[model samples]
Target: MRKIWLTGIAALAMASCTSKTSTPQPTASALAALPTTDWKSFRDTFIEDWFKVSPADAVYQGRHDFDGGLGDWSPAGLKRQGDFLRNAIAKAKTFDAAKLGKQDAFERDYLVTVAAGKLFWLEDADFPHRNPAWYVNAGLDPNVYIARKYADAPTRMRAMVSFLRKIPTAAAQIRANLKTPMPLSYVNFGVAAFNGFGDYYTGDAKKAFADVKSPALQEEFDKAAVAASKAMHDLGAWLEGQRGSATQDFALGADKFSRMIKETERVDVPLATLEAAGQADMKRNQLALVAACAQFAPGASVPACMAKMNANKPANNDPVAEARKQIPELRAFVLKSDVVTIPDQEQALVEESPPYNRQNSAYIDPPGPFEKGIPSVYYISPPDPSWSKVEQAGFIPGKSDLLFTSVHEVMPGHFLQFRHANASPSLFGRLFVGYAFAEGWAHYAEEMMWEAGLHAGDPETHIGQLSNALLRDCRYLSAIGLHAHGMTQEQSRKMFVEQCYQDEGNAKQQSARGTYDPAYLNYTMGKLMIRKLRTDWTATHGGRAGWKAFHDQFLSFGGPPIPLVRKAMLGGDGKAVF
Candidate 1:
């Protein structure tokens, strides 16, 4: 699961220069002072400037100076964000590469790449107008105040009140910005998320901060919460009303989809080539699943075989409890296997997902790099109660399947990757983790754990890991097919069931997810690139013996696009990132 703070459209390196107007420009003096010796200070200032516009990001990064703030989401605000990125990109390109050292040059490229990625979404894609998820995930989230223990209860409560008070305006801005006749799946997502926020504000959010002892604050919180809840519910109702005109126009088309990969992930492979890679991986995982099924459930079909594994659901069907038990063992295994360095002893807590943010089955909410001693939270979402009992049951992961998920979200996956990221020397790298790099590493860790002898020779465990791989493979193809090849959601869902062997419920969820999250293909793409890099790097760096060193070095770059890391690692153009 992605971090709450980092999961939104606007969360990806929001802005570089602070811009008060729609068309911000670098000062002539600023541009004239080019190629200065203080690259580090410039980078640091960029981050500080970014926080002024994207305060929520700062709050999550453990910078309390911007604790109660949210990004401006009005039309003017959106234009300023885009303008800021454009100005920042221009300034970044002005620095002389020859004057900057190799590391500084690399950092310059990294910042430019980040700013470009953000620009693509803000200006090129026009997500703020076309996608409600941009607002829902970016501005509407209050998880930081509720979950992180960065401050005392009273302080956090105060921040929460400040946040809630702003939501009425944020809600209006979101409703105004989202043009109508949206994709059906997108409309539903917006409806559910907005309504969920309404429910959460008056329920869990209120309770979480109940211990704060101040009548004045309590009165303020109550008034703010009521308005916020009403605003959310009204927004949800408005989105639901859009169901009458909802269309199936969710595709980014081939061109923008193609650019999405290059700009955001730094991957320039042809879409057909990318599709072929996913298809080949799908076949590989399918064959492995067949062999594993033969061993685990003789004479049964693939679906039945998966059902058998999934039948052994978590104890009491409580994934949160099961996840807790799994993590300690997973941590111990990673240590014993010596696959990667843990960097620190910080542990992650397992929790049930909050109602407003249960879009993903599970995700790890790690503390930002600037934070210290704060535990990460691994949240597992229970099935929606509206579903039929069987569908709900199908939503719960089987014990073996949950184990690999544990491996993905905690242990040697997101949790450990973040621990290494927190130790990074480069602040830019620590702050601007690319989507593909983060998800890809977590997904790759699942397979790596299995290869490292996690439940070695156990067919069920192997099936568990392969289940996830096949799911990602299907996502890779589904994203391409849905967005670029004119595939319908039903077609994608059926493919998930028949080819990926997903349950009906999961297939539905995964298929719908592709429309909104086209770049989700990164799970497989990132894993493949990382695996290829490992083979090439380990060939000379002690082969299999270099696993820990490779992991440590790879993570040291924080979370740049994998290609950038590949170049840094292999010391060439790194054009062969595949």
Candidate 2:
């Protein structure tokens, strides 16, 4: 749902500045007159340095000064980024956490945590050379300029032209950086993403800017877009040519897998322990699904019960319209139930997914914290046209299922969370949200809404919520299985279908996704952590009366790793995450 590639590295920005001053030593009195360490100033300086290295991220955060800019993904540029992170990690560790104020110390720890995660991907994982999704997801998406109205048409058009003009070079750098003999799944994803970008750049992207009536600027745009499209097409073609040689060596293996979870999410549970947790959740959900089906589908098998639930598709086969109608209902329920605070009246617009970014079925593109008066967009991807009719039909979510999707992507989920995050006093917290924190909260919202009596006791509605939970549980296991235990792609796919009750099209898509995104396990992992935190905190705070207080306090941290938030809330390390 979020920019998976850049989130880790974006905030980890300082390349340690060394000095060569040879002045005389200060007297004790002069030393006493000097100011103490200012954590805020140091943190701000690091963020400013980060903007230069990851300008695309800055642009997303509504820093228009960086509009149309891209990160340097070339070999030297990547090395520079890695150096910056390593130095940032080293620099952050120099500060004595005990000396800093409570909030400052927390922020410092958050910075170190983020930098470590980034270093793992940039250096240890070697994602730039190994995974095409790294490039695809590394804040290269141009949807912001088109979707958000942060500027006049002419101004945004100029930014688009400048951005498009740089794509050819970026595309070449991406192609050169990616080493071949990639996993077949990665290669195919790369092919689809690049070619899809080519399609959008020439088609929808150009049209989005057509309203800009400057002939000179229009000419400039045409030239730039054409070049960008060609570069994208060429890159896609190159990846396609490597299809014959594609390997299945995508697994991170057990040790790296364990380290990945630890470094990225701050979760250090053993693989066996984590897998058992996931398996237990799946079984629990399966049992709940059966109980719901007994009332909803009578004697049908589990698959048949799910089939019956899915058959209640959106009217006229249009999910966008159905989603639009559900927004107010979901929003009202969140308020009525007092599950969480909706910080503002700002509503999310619903639309179909653009060609270039159909990786996830649904995702919310919220405006950055610095931007004002711009609405967030919730995008839903249609089935791939190449799929069979039945598969396409299966891809369309049922009305009940769509309700939870709305809950997850908007309403009291991501959009509401962002509203609180945007108000964060910390710039780093406002601008950068970790994957586990963001997705975990959203996934947790689905069940939270159900527990708060959304469509209370209705079998169909309960099925929708449980189905979503089952999907995440499968992801939790599949991620550990695929990356740590050498589970085959086919095995992962079967688990999605049989265990999660996902449709054929979704099962295949989800399994292939595990190859490039082993961290997709964060959804369920995050949810479990959050649930535990809520239970632990509310038990002492005010029992059920503290639900709203818990929700508000939880979202106020913006999006750090869950373990960090857990520690903050529980007043200790809160060692067990799952």
Candidate 3:
């Protein structure tokens, strides 16, 4: 549930500016006279503007300042936000980052990056109009349900009612602002999602809203649900009417895509280099998959072995409990085997995927430092009772796959990495780092755990891990190719099926996902960067150091770009923390 906002390179560009006056340097006394309050004020304004534009983010951070409110997607709202960020960026450059303390300087740098990214998107990318997934109601989007956690039952119902009332206005703005094609497609998806929401409310609201069984409450809930349903349907109908005429390309051209990579991952590599790396990793994973298959079934070829393994998927039965049972065993194996330091404060709790989030198989909900007593929920989606056994089997993790997924989502992965981020010295750093780092580290952890022999007892576990890696690497290729290199959906699907060995259904779903989320490339790309970073650092620092020591040191600095990591760790001056 970590909402890592995307920071653009423009922010860093603002921070990197230096005055070029030929005047004599100021005296030490004069330099010291510059008030720290000025920089603090700048930081405060940036944070304030950030929260205003991203209220869902504030709610997630346990700040309910805008609990009942939603984002303003109107053209006027977008212009206002853009103007605010531009003004903030101009103000930010006046403060000297070097004169501030490390933490304050990091905050200033982050604020600049955030503002720059926002401005870039608004002015250059024109994402609000071009991306279909921008408004889709998906499990990955935390905005719709954030208020549910903060409010009581009646209050939650009221919030939903209020949210529903605004949906038409928001939809109108979306339609006005968006390019013809993408919004229609997105609205189709959004309508489909809203259908599921209606079902969820019908099933769960009875008990939850018991105290509100009066005619008034029922009427309000009914009206809201009906309005939501109608709006979604109407949107979908409108989208269908324009199907043949829709003409917005979702691609983020090479320059913008490259900039995104540089700003988000701090990598200087070109798209070609990333593609080559991903291809090589995919080949390596294929070889590993073959090797693993040979161990599992000596006479079977890799494809045959994978077919057998897929056919032998476990039956769905209390998936959450079954998944939970594997965690302690996996945790113990990881710790005893010296894979990575499992923090003492770690607490992994298994929970059913919220009815709203059932589409995703599972997700790690890591608690922030501010949420100390709150348990980290490893949300597992249980099979719908309506599903046939065969249909259900596809999602139920077999014992080996269960352990592998647990290790990736919980132990020594997301839960652990986030705990470290939460413990960071710079609150702004904890608050502002991008999703590439968080997701990339978790994906990276999956491979690192396998390398450390955490999957030793079961070769199938190794194969499962490799299969997952292949799918992710393929995702990297598909995301970059589709969004940046003009790759077609058919091409991406072929890549997934042929290289990643994914089933046709899953491959198709993933290809559709790419149209909206170009950053899906981050999982594999980020992980590869982290692994390469670790290898280079280890070679420089000697291989004798414990993995725990290396890992602790690496994560001690809040999740900065990998390039910045070198400066953070090696630049002992402590001023390069961000």
Write one digit per residue (lDDT tens) for candidate 1, span 98-150: 89988888898888888788788777878899987777656577887788877
Candidate 3 residue 355 Cα shift, in angstroms, is 6.6
Error of 2 at 509 (Å): 0.3
lDDT of 2 by residue, 1-578 (tens): 65443363222322111111111222223212211267776677667666666777766667776677787788777877777777777777778989987888888888887878888988878898999888777766788778878888777777877778779989989888888789999998999999999998889988998878799988988998999999999999999999999999999999999999888878888788888888888999999999999999999998999999999999999999999999999998988988788887899999998988887788888877767788889999999999999999999999999999999999788889888988776666786788888888999999999989999789999999998999999888999999989899999999999989999999999999999988899899889989989999999999989999999999999888888888989888746566
Measured over all alpha carbons after superposition, the RMSD of each candidate to the real structure, in angstroms, is 3.8, 6.1, 8.6
lDDT scores for all predictions? 0.82, 0.83, 0.61
Error of 1 at 109 (Å): 1.2
How many residue pairs collide in each prediction? 1, 0, 1
TM-score of 1: 0.95
Over 4 Å off, model 2: 3-36
What does candidate 2 score in Cα RMSD to the true structure?
6.1
lDDT of 3 by residue, 487-566 (tens): 88778888887888776555655676666666778778778767766775677676735566678777766566555565
Model 1, stretches more than 4 Å misplaced?
Answer: 4-37
Error of 1 at 548 (Å): 1.4
